[model samples]
Target: MKKVIVGNHAVSWGVQLARTEVISAYPITPQTQVVEQLSEMCASGELNARFIKVESEHSAMAACMGASAAGARAFTATSSQGLALMHELLHWAAGARHPIVMADINRSLGPGWNIWTEQTDSLAQRDTGWVQLYCETNQEVLDTTIMSFRLAEQVNLPVMLVLDAFYLSHTAEPVDIPDRELVDAFLPKRQARLKLDTAEPHSFNALVPPASYMEMRHALQEAMREARTAFDEVEEEWEQRFGRRYGAVEAYHTDDADLVLVTSGTVTSTARHVIDQRRAAGERVGLVKIKMFRPFPTETLRAALAGIARVAVLDRNLSPGRGGIFAEELRAALYDVPAEDRPQVYGYVLGLGGRDIRPDTIDTVIERTRAAAAPDREDLWVGLLGDDGAPATTGRAQTSADSLPGVEA
Candidate 1:
C-alpha cells in the first residue's frame, strides 16, 4: 500500500507489519507519535499486540527485555533523554541478546532542554552492544525498521533504527507500505533458542567468573561480526521482495573521484545535493552514506574509501573533547589501510543541536579540505557558535535553509 505518512507513523506501520508481539515505549517529543500510534493500534485491535505503556523509558526497555525473555518478539521507540535514561537497560537488552528493535528519533540532549534533532544521544550508546542503523529518509525509516527486526533476531542482538527528529520523524513523505502477508513471510515470529522456558528451568544471565567473562564478550563481538553479513542477506531478500535496498553502506559516484564526503542520517540528503552541484562543474566529488554504524563496517568503509585522495567526514554528533564520533570511528576503520593508499580523512563536526547543515556549509568544508594539509584528526566545528556565540565562518548562502556561512547568532 502507498501512503503519505510521517516518519514516526512509518515506523509504527513497520512494527505493525513485523507483528511485534510486545510494543513498549514511553512518550517523548519526536518519538511520542510512534508510541501513540502503536497504542492506538493496540487499543483498536488493529494490531494484535500488547502495548505496554510504561511510566518511563527505562521501564519501557525493561518491559521489552522481560517480554523478549518470555519468548515474545519485542520492540520500542525513544529519543534523547529517554534513550539516555534507558542507557543501563540498553546494555541489558543487548547483553541478554533480546533482539528488541528500537526506533530512536535522534534528538538533541538537554541541560537547557531543547527538543530538536541531534545524533549524540544514539552515538553515546556506541559502547552498548546494539546494532545501530541510521535512516536517511521516511521510506528508509519504515524499511529499516522491518529489516532491523530480522537483523536483530538473526544475531540475537538489539537493533536501533535511527532517524533525525524533525527531518524524518515529523516530515511526511510518500512511502510504500509493504503488505502484511509479505512481511509475515519475510519476518516470521522470532524463535529464541535460549528463551526463558519454564519447562527448562535453568539459570540465565547469572554473574560469570573472570574466566567466563572475556569469552562471553568475545561471543557478542563474534555475533556482531556475523550480523554484518546477516544484515546484507536480509537486505538482499528485502530487495527481492520489495525492489528497494540500501546496503549496509551506500557509495555514490565514487569512480575516478578525488574527494568523497562521508555522511549519515538526513545530512546525506543535503550532502547528495552538494555533491551533485560540485560534480556537474567538473569537480571530482562523491558521497558515501553510512547506514550501519555498529560492527563498524571497517572493511566495507575501507574498500569504499580506498584510492580516494581526500575524504571529508561530516560528523553531526560530537564526542566533546574527543571530536566527532563517526569521524573517530572512520579513521580507526581506515587506520590499517597503508598510508600511501589511505585517504586523508578530515573530520568536520557540524549541525549539532538541530542547526540546519547547509549545502554551503558542506561546500565550505570541501573547500577547506582542498586548501588544507593532512588533518591532525582535530574536529573542525563548522558553522558552530564561536566563543563569542557567533557564526564561525561565512562562505556563501546557497539556499533559503542555509543556516551556514555568516550564521547570525
Candidate 2:
C-alpha cells in the first residue's frame, strides 16, 4: 500500500514488518517520532513487541544489547547527542556480535545546543564495528530498515540506518509500505548463529587474556570484511523480490561525465535534481550517492569515480577546521591511485542545523568546484548564509581532527 510518510514513520513501518521482538529507545528530536510511533503500535496491539521506555540513549542501547543477546530481534532509534551517549554500548553490542538494527536521525553536535541535520554524529563512530547505511529518501529508509536486519544478522554486526534529521525525518512523501507477508517471506524469523543465552549454562562476556584479546578483535574485523559480500547478497535477494536495488555507493549519470558529485542522506536527492538540470544545460556533471559509511566502500568508490576528471564531495557535517566530513573520506579512498588517474576532489560544506539547500545552491557548488581545481586552491563553502561563511578549511588540523585515527578522509 502507498501512503505519505515521514522517514521516521517509514522506519517504524519497516520495524513492524520485520517483526522486531524488542524495541528500546530514548526521546530526542527527529528520532523521537520513530520510537513514539513504534510505541503506539505496540500499545495498540498492532505490533507484537516489548516496548521499553528507557532513561537515556545509553540505557536504550544497553537494553537492546541485552535483548538481542537473549535471542530477540532488537531495535532502537536516536540522534546527535543521544547517539554520542550510546557510543560505549555501541562497541559492546558489536563485540557481543548482536544483530541489532538502529535508526539514527543525523543531527549536529553542539555546545550551543542545536537540533538539526548533520552526518557528524554517525560518521564520527565509523569505526565502532557497525554497518552504516545513509538513506536518500523516505522509501529508502523503509527498505533499508528491513534489509539492515538481514545484512547485520548474516555477519553478526549491528547496522545503523542514518538519515538527515529534518530533511527526510520530517518531510512527507509517498512510500510503498510492503505487505507484511512479503516482508516475512524476505526477512523471516530472527536466528542468531551464536548466542549468549542458553538452555544449558555457559560463560559469556568473559575476561579475555592479553594473549588472546587481539586475536578476538581480529576475528570481528574479519567478520566485518565478510559483511561486504553479505550486504551484496541481501540486496540481491531484496531486488529479486522488490524490483529495487541499492549499492554500497549508488552512481548516477557518471557515464561519460567529466565531474561527479558525491553525497549522502537527503542531499543526494537535491544533488540529483541539480545534475539533471545541468545535464539539460549541457554540463557533464553526475552524482554518487554513498549508502555505506563504515566498512568504507573504497574499492567501489574508486571504480565509480575512476574516469571522472574532477569530483566534488558536499558534506552537511562540519569537522570544525578540517571542512566537510565526507570529503576527507573520499580523498583517502582515492589517495593511493595515481594523481593523474585519481579525480580532483573538491569539498563543500552546507546545510547544517535544518537550513534549506535549494537546487540552485548545489548548482553553485558544482560551478565553483570546477573553477577551483588547482592543487593550491582552497576548499569551497556553499550557502554559508552569514558573515561567518569563511572559505572552506582543508586537511586535518589539531583543532579539527578526532583523536582516534583510521577514519580515512
Candidate 3:
C-alpha cells in the first residue's frame, strides 16, 4: 500500500509492521510524532504492543532494556537533548547485547536554543557499540526501521537508525508501506539467544573482574565486526524480497571521476543534484552517500575511493576542537591505504544548527577543493555569517580567497 506520510510516521509504520512487542519513549521535538503514532497504534489495538509511559528519555531507554532483556522485540524514538539524556543506557543496551531498535531524529544540541536538523547528536554516540544507519528519505526510513530489527537480532547488538529533523521528520513524502505479512515473513518473532527467563533464571550483566573484562570487551568488538558483514546479508535478503536496496555506502559516478563528495542524510540528496549538473557539463564529479556510520563500511569505502584523485567530505556535524566527525573517521580509514592510492581528503564543515546547505554551497566546496594545493586547515567552515550578517570567511582564516559568496551559510 502507498501513502503520503512524514518520516516520523514512516518510523511508526515500520515499527508497527515489524510487530514490535514493546514501545517506550519520552516525547521530544521532531521525534515525538514517532512514538505518539505508535502509542495510538497500541491504544487502538492496531499494534498489539506495550506502550510504556516514561517520564524521561533515560527512563525510556531503561524500560526498553528491561523489555529486551525478557526476549521481547523492543523499540523507541528520541531527538537531540533527549538522546543525550539516554547516553548511559545506550552503552548498557549495547554491552548487554540487546537487540533493541531505536529511531533517532537528528536535532542540534541546545544553547542558542535551536531545534533544527543536525547529525552531531547521533554521531556523538558512535562508540557506544550500536549499529548506526542514517537514512536519506522517508522510504528508506521506513525500510531501515524494519531491517534494523533483523540486523540487530542477527548480531545481538542494539541498532539506531537516524533521520534528519523537520527535513524528514515533518516533510511529507510518498512511501510504499510494505504488507504486514511480508514484513512478518522477513522479520519473524525475535528469538533472543540469551534472556532473563523465569524457568532458567540466571545472572545478567554481572560484574566482570579484571580477569575477564578485557575478553568481554573483545567479544563486543568481534560482534561489531560480525555486524558489518551481517548487515550486507540482511540487505541482500531485503532487496530480494522487496526489490529495493540501499548500500551501506553508495557510490555514484565514481568509477571514472577525479573528485567525489562524501555526504550523508539529507545533504546527499542535494549533492546528487549538483553531481548531476556537473556531470552534464562534462566535469568528473561524483558522490558517495554513507548510510551506515557504525561498523564504518571501511572496506566498501576503500573499494569506492581507492584511486580517486581528491575526496571532499561534507559533514554537518563537528567534533569541537577536532574537525568534521565523518571526515576525521574517513581520513583514519584511508590512512592504511597505499600512499599512491589514497585520495587527499578535504573536510568541510557546514549546515550545523540547521543552517541551509544549498547547491551553490556545495559548488563552492567543489571549486575550493579542486583549486587548492592541499587543505588550508582541517575544518573548512562553509556558508558562515559575520557579526553584521555579511558572508564570513572560512573558519581558519579571513582571506579574500576563503570568502564564500553566493551561498547560504
Candidate 4:
C-alpha cells in the first residue's frame, strides 16, 4: 500500500512490519514521534509487542538489551543527548552481541541549548561497534529500517538508521509501504543462535581477564567485517523482491567528471539538483552519496573516486579541534592509494545546528574547490555568520534560496 508519511512514521511502520517483539525508548525531540506511534500500535493490537516505558534513554536501551538477550527481536529510537546518555550501554549491547535496531534522528547537541539537526551525535558514537546507515528519503528510511534488523540479526551486531531531524523527521513524503505479507517473507522471526534460556541458564558478558580479552575484541571486529558483506547480500534480496536497491555508496555522473561532491543525509538531495544543473551546463561535475557509515565502505569509495581529479566532502558534523569527521575518515581511507590514483580531498563543514545548506552554498564550494591549487588539511566552514550575524567572509558568495525555484529558505 502507498501512503504519505513523515520519516519518523516510516520508521514506525518498518518496525511494525519487522514484527519487533519488544520496544523501549524515552521521549526526545524528533525521535519521540517514532516511539509514540509504536506505542499506539502496541495498544491497538496492530503490532503484537511489548512497549517498555522507561525513565530515561539509558534505561530504555538497558531494557532492549535484556529483551534481545532473551531471544526477542527488540528495537528503539533516540536522538542527540539521549543517544549520548546511552553511551555506556551501547558498548554492552555490541559487546554482548545483541541484535538491537535503533533509529537516531540527527539533532544538534546542547550547550547553546538548541533542538535542531546535526550529525555530531551519531558520529561521536563511531567507536561503539555498531553498524550505522544514513538515509536520504522517507522511502529509504522505511526500507533501511527493515533491512537493518535482518543485517543485525545475521551478524549479531546492533544497527542504527540515521535521518535528518526536521528535514526528514517532520517533513511528510509519499512512501510505498510494503505489504506485511511481503515483509514477513523477507524477514521472518529472528532465531537467535545463542539466547538466555531458563532451562540452561548460562552467564553472558562475564568478566574478561587479559588472558582472553583481546580475542573477544578481535571477534567483535570480525563480526563487523562480516556485516560489510552481509549488508550487500541483504540489499540484493530486498531489491529482487521490492525492485529498489540503495548501495552503501551511490555514484552519479562520475564516469568522466573531474570533480565529485560527496554528501550524506538531506544535503544529498540539494547536491543532486546542483549536479544535474552542472552536468547540463557541461561543467564536468558529479556526486557521490554515502548511506552506510559504519563498517566504512572503504573499498567501494576507493573504486568510485580513486582517479578523479578532485573530491570534495561536505560534512554536517564536526569533531572540535580536528575537522569534519567524514572528511578525516575519507582522507585516511584514500591515503594508501597509489599517488597517481589518489584524488586531492577538499573538506567543507556546513549545515551544523540545522543551518540551511542552499544550492548556492554548494555552488560556492564547487567554485572554491576548482580554484584551489592544493586541498587544505583543515575543512572550510560554509554559511557561517559573524558577531553581527552577517555572513562571514568564507570565500563563498552569499546566495539566497530564492535563486533556485522549488528550494525553500
> Number of the top candidate by TM-score?
3
Tens-digit lDDT string for candidate 4 (326-346): 999999999999999899998
Over the full model, what C-alpha lDDT does candidate 2 score relative to the true structure?
A: 0.85
Give the Cα lDDT of each candidate.
0.89, 0.85, 0.92, 0.92
Q: Where does candidate 2 clash, by residue pair?
A: 328-409, 329-409
Instruction: After the best TM-score superposition of candidate 1, give how far the Cα of residue 135 lies from its true spot, in angstroms.
Output: 0.3
lDDT per residue as tens, model 3, 1-409: 9999999999999999999999999999989999889989999999999999899999999999999999999999999999999999999999999999999999999887889999999999999989999999999999999999999999999999999999899999999999988999999998988789988898999988999988988999999999999999999999999988899999999999999999999999999999999999999999999999998999999999999989999999989888799999999999999989999998899999999999988988899788776765556888788667876544453232543443222
Q: How many Å off is the CA of 278 in candidate 3?
A: 0.8
lDDT of 3 at 228: 94
Per-candidate clash tally = 0, 2, 1, 0
Q: Would you list the rank order by TM-score, best first?
A: 3, 4, 1, 2
Q: What's model 3's TM-score?
A: 0.97
lDDT of 1 by residue, 278-333 (tens): 88998999999999999789889999999999999999898877888999999888
List the candidate 2 regions with Cα displacement exceeding 4 Å: 375-378, 385-409
Q: Of 3 and 4, which scores higher on TM-score?
A: 3
Estimated TM-score for each candidate:
0.95, 0.92, 0.97, 0.96
**CA lDDT of 214 in candidate 3?**
85
lDDT, candidate 2, 307-340, per-residue tens? 7898988888877667777888888889988777
- Where does candidate 4 stray beyond 4 Å? 393-409
TM-score result, candidate 2: 0.92
Worst 10 residues of 3 by lDDT: 400-409
Total clashing pairs in model 3: 1
- Write down the RMSD of all candidates, one decimal each: 4.1, 5.3, 2.0, 4.4
